[model samples]
Target: MSTRRTLLAGSTAALGLAAGAAHAAPSVTAPQPAAAPGGRPPNLVVVLADDLGYGELGAYGQKLIATPRLDGFPAEGLQFTDAYSTAAVCAPSRGSLLTGLHAGHATVRANPSSGARVP
Candidate 1:
């Protein structure tokens, strides 16, 4: 992975996408937090970018890096435009994204330098 570290991990790999989850930290001006009123269970932020590619950000359009808070996660979280990763490295794609099992039945399939210990 070296076209200058894949353009420096696709230019410092960032995808914020934390919009209005009760506007605690994801602020555009703060004060728009009222929706979880019925059963409640929505707020989620699960961004994991190792090599970084999914149109490289700006909420998957990426017009030369602006990414206004990762373009506010498809208007507030949950955007998986045809996702696919079960190991291009990163310890078997984080052990099949924490144990769903894909990267050869997962469990740290690689990325252990030369010691590689996870028996």
Candidate 2:
């Protein structure tokens, strides 16, 4: 198999294991936002990192990393321990996340090379 394929496979397996571990933990209820005035939607922010390990964050029990702000997120926001990415690779994962679909259902599955033409 190609290096990219191998890496994707490994990442998928690792993420699956992490998800299982998260599933074993107790669930937490997310706090709901207050209704906006004039029926306007509330602002939302999502932070995503590539190739970040679960144990690298202070909130996830990393004593070495000084993530004070991130550590405090649980107090004011909902934290999901069992969350998962739809794909092992960036392009596919992002597509699945945006579309709310799994890898099998997502339209884009892999990142094509710069010179590769995509339809």
- The reply for model 1, stretches above 4 Å from the true place, is 1-39, 43-50, 53-55, 59-61, 64-88, 100-106, 111-119
The candidate maximizing TM-score is 2
- Write down the lDDT of every candidate, Cα atoms only: 0.63, 0.68
TM agreement with the true structure for every prediction: 0.26, 0.49
User: Residue 18 in model 1: shift from native, Å?
Assistant: 30
Candidate 2 Cα deviation (angstroms), residue 27:
44
Which of the numbered candidates is closest to the native, going by highest lDDT? Answer: 2
Model 2 per-residue lDDT tens digits across residues 6-67: 64566567667666766665563333335789676576667777667778888788898698
Please state the error at residue 25 of candidate 2 in Å.
52
Model 1 per-residue lDDT at 93: 85
CA displacement after TM-score superposition, residue 117 of candidate 1 (Å): 19
